[model samples]
Target: MKIYIITVLLILLSMCSCQTDSSPLPILGRHDISETDTVYHRIPDFKFINQDSNYVTNSDLKDNIYISDFFFMSCPSICPIVKKQMLRVYDKYKDNDRVKLVSHTIDPKRDTPEKLKKYAQKLNIDDSVWMFLTGEKGEILDIADDYFVAAFEDPDAPGGFDHSGKMILTDTKRHIRAFAEGTDPEDVDQFLIDIDKLLVEYAQ
Candidate 1:
């Protein structure tokens, strides 16, 4: 009887340990975004010019997790705050090969490829893993829409475009797995947590 009880106790302890150290998000309540639609919908494909003026498509980013945010290079307000927060993220993961960062200029009309390159350098962007992209206005809007993010021209607004300052995290499968507020460093902690979770899952 004593031996049987000890075996049962060992099994319970193993199960408890497994639950405590599980990889990936534990099955919880509903997610903020639709995780199911991505599993079944037709994947979006669009080409956009990168900071180098080279075309980048969904296919180009396969097998890597990427974080994307939108801002204009000439903005005088919240854009700078977002960019500063992103710098922290870049510095933390510059040497991480499997991770990438993409910043899309909402005002592509003024942010030419050369201008973007200069802006990136000014920010001390991690060129090895980060890209500041610019392309035609329509193409940029289209790609933003495909990601279920929002951007629109608002001539009345200071920058002529009303864009959200949010950073979205996409898994290697091209599904958006998490989002963080772009202007707040505290919100970036959530981004870091999700990134770590995705990396562990991908490793498996």
Candidate 2:
């Protein structure tokens, strides 16, 4: 009888551990949500021109989950490192139609559609799966704010602009499901796991 009770207790503990590990990632940016409130935040609508000069809006990504980041082509400090990490993410999901990558440039004047095209080509990125976007500088900054990324022009800063190296993951409903430091390989590795979790979440 004692052996049977220990086995039952162990099984129950394992089940509880699974439940804890499987809890969904939180919906960020809830300003007024109470403990009992279950409100979810979502990315707002915006339009921008992609590398191919095609307009991309929230509606365009309605059925897909995507990763988003902000950078300028001329950034000399963190952009290259962040892009390398992003490339890892790209390689992981390149063949999955449900996933996409959106890179918004803070320097619109310098990162025009043509320039972005060449950058993508140099990086060997698939324009169909990844979009390098540029538009009015102020508009791009506003959209960056929507993603909780800081971007601005700093004449004193390196390469004429300053921006955070943050990569955000959003689900099909436009909810921000997770994020990671774009410069940290370990954080990005965990982010990849989060991406898989979101994929499994919606697949169910």
* Reference-based lDDT, each prediction: 0.78, 0.91
**Model 2 clashing residue pairs (backbone):** none
Candidate 2 wrong stretches, greater than 4 Å: 1-4, 14-20, 31-39
lDDT of 1 by residue, 31-125 (tens): 34565542332226767788788988877788778888888977776888888878877887788888899889989889998998888888877
TM-score of each: 0.80, 0.90
Model 1 residue 10 distance off true place after TM-score fit, in angstroms: 16
Best by the TM-score measure? 2
**Total residue pair clashes for candidate 2:** 0
Q: At residue 82, what lDDT does model 2 achieve?
A: 96
Residue-wise lDDT of candidate 2 within 95-165, one digit each (tens)? 99999999999999989999999999999989989999998888899878878998888899999998899
